[model samples]
Target: MAVETGAGARAGMEAPALEGGAVLGSLLDLKADALGTYLRARQRHGDVVRIHVGPPGLRMDMYCVFSAEGAQQVLASESANYRKDNPFYEEIRESFGNGLLTAQDADYLRQRRLVQPLFTRRRVDGYAGAVAEETAGTLASWARARDAIVDVSDEMMHLALRAVSRILFGADADATTDVVHRCFPVITEYVLRRGYSPLNVPRTWPTPGNRRAAAAAEELYGVCDRIIAERRAGGDPAEDLLTLLAGAQSPDGEGFDTAELRDQVLIFLLAGHETTATSLAFTLHLLGRHPEEQARAREEVVRVLGDRTPEAADLDRLPYLTRVLKEAMRLYPAAPVFGRNAVAAGEIDGYAVPAGATVVLAPWVTHRHPRYWSDPDRFDPGRFTPEAEASRPRYAWFPFGGGPRACIGQHFSMLESVIALAMLLRAYEIEAVDTEVPLSAGMTLRAEGPMRCRIRPVRR
Candidate 1:
């Protein structure tokens, strides 16, 4: 075979390129509407597109892959060639510490081995009682606001934070719930701004944004550290996630140190609540908008639970409701876009991908790909039916990502979300007050405006 290397391979690269010439090509569009920009790029440029951003000397290449096959390749098949060494991940590592989410190589392997046991189906299912208790509290609050508008986004955020905090810290949850709720928005917004910026002032600088974020980080980290210290002092053992995490030890007696524990706790606090909150809030919003689906889901909940509080075991029983949540995830994935850096030269869809370039995978786009979905934009829970799902590619709906580095909290997230949704639907009938929700792509997906819904007590 004839050789094609270097300039020859570069010239024959088959990917379509979108050039955003000079200082900031597509940067503004990305900042303003990341989801829209990515969707449009996919629609116009097909599954594989080479996007050019930044100015002359500092120009950057993003090999954007929107196909399900491409997602599987990058996230699973050829994962070794695509590592999480990109600027976005670097920012996350800097802010969150090298927890399981950002840990690489041997560090990731060790952490996963130790932490994997805590997130197994049986272990995570045990947290169902905590989820139900928190949901009941939220239901009580919603009952008080009967016939009034509630910001579903904020409400779900609070509900999820309380549930996860209680599970993670047990008695110490109260100390951090309000602090995390107050500080996360500021911290996440700061991360999004800095993570996407072509250039940034040092976080150590006393700029207003830097100072605000630093203060938030300090307060957040202090509370977690204090709690972890107290737990390590051989105090009364609480049956919480932290207790389990601290108790986790390897065959050689290795375990997470105090600092490592803090990093893991921080990542859990971020991923555990934030993603589930988004799922719950968006599911409610979608259900509220589509009353027929809402009625159907509620009907399923009633059929299955019959005025009883939902448990983890009930997750599979509530099939229709589960589908509703899945549909919501399809429309508004919590983590819309994630990136991986090419460790070496590769080809996606026959287009040459240069080493060191970032490959972006966006569930927000892939979920709606014309090839995979019949009515891409419409909200339909039936799409998740077992047979329907079987008809599509495996990577067509990867809300939690894929492969060895996939989210460890996947089952926990589902258990929490399904239980909470069952309870919420059983307790109240909600109608979306704000029909349209504008989104801001942050470290996670967020509603740019209030996702308000009017709720009335369900008449038995």
Candidate 2:
């Protein structure tokens, strides 16, 4: 695979290289399960371990940090030294283009600056109504069911997609949503596979994988183009996020063309929705598994919100629900592992990291680090209480990550998730259809397959 650092306050000790099981080469291990491979290496070699990947000259060694200290050094303390064109991002660019999630250097800065205002407090607060509306719509659909043993994972994705669409482009996107519902999975599947593939297959190569990836990307972009075209053809749909983004002018004074607009729309639809959906799905999954916690969360919902949908102001009133969401993210972070490649020499925990080394920052591992969390594997929302949170390092729980480049939509995601959770818990009693919920890693962590749940309506 293509090759890959951070800093310190030293160059003497080389970071320990991961050995043993990885002796068969990193490809074999990664082919098994990339996250597992990294976890095993970290377990064997400590917080920072270097693993060599790929075949022959194409092989590269990447330094992965699975500790809070390393996260601080690489993400916060010396963040400027690592740019956006990290190894994982290189794979992301093909699908996302130069959008905020994939842009680098000046491009990334410019994009972040332009998009930051869109997620301002007022705008995010205004979107709460839309989030609640979508959640209500989902409940209505479930009510129409005879038995209602619905796939919560799919429902979460659908609901999130609808809410984000309403926010971005206004309502009534039947055609566009259908295409995305069909094609988004194909794009993600190919992206994850190629992102971890040992073979250096170029996107231009007409191999089966490349063809499938390209086709999916094309259809998804096609859906975006259709949305823009419909909006342009039908005149204004009041003033919304899409209108603002479309009218936004670059530094040189030129507005984004159709292609640039498509990129932004794709990134928002892809990154914004999927992560939120996964977070909500896993939150519900966990709540369903632990009935006691679910009951507590629902109690808070009932106490704060009698029977009406949750409002933006009501979010603060239910602190236990917030803790439940925070704990869920800590246990199963939506965007688990994202990497940053060093643009300059840096040191982490006294270990020297050269320029171009990819440093993996995994929230999944760090959030569960024994050093920072007690009973790391346990699902205890009490751990997120005000006193408990204050006792730990700020970076110890980074479901939204740390530093300047942390998610711009953190507020949006939290509000949407909190609203959805409250509404769902208020309406029904949920239980996992499967005794053990399996896990899988994509761009974000997700349930292995469709996570089906039994929804029993609560008596009024």
Steric clash pairs (candidate 2): 4-356, 4-357, 6-346, 6-347, 7-347
**Residue-by-residue lDDT tens digits, candidate 1, 213-256:** 89999999999998888889869579898988988999999999
Clashes of 2: 5
Top TM-score prediction, candidate number: 1
Q: Give the number of colliding residue pairs in candidate 1.
A: 0
Best by lDDT: 1
Candidate 1 structure lDDT: 0.89
* TM-score for all models, in order of appearance: 0.96, 0.93
TM-score of 2: 0.93
Clash count of each predicted structure:
0, 5
lDDT of each: 0.89, 0.81
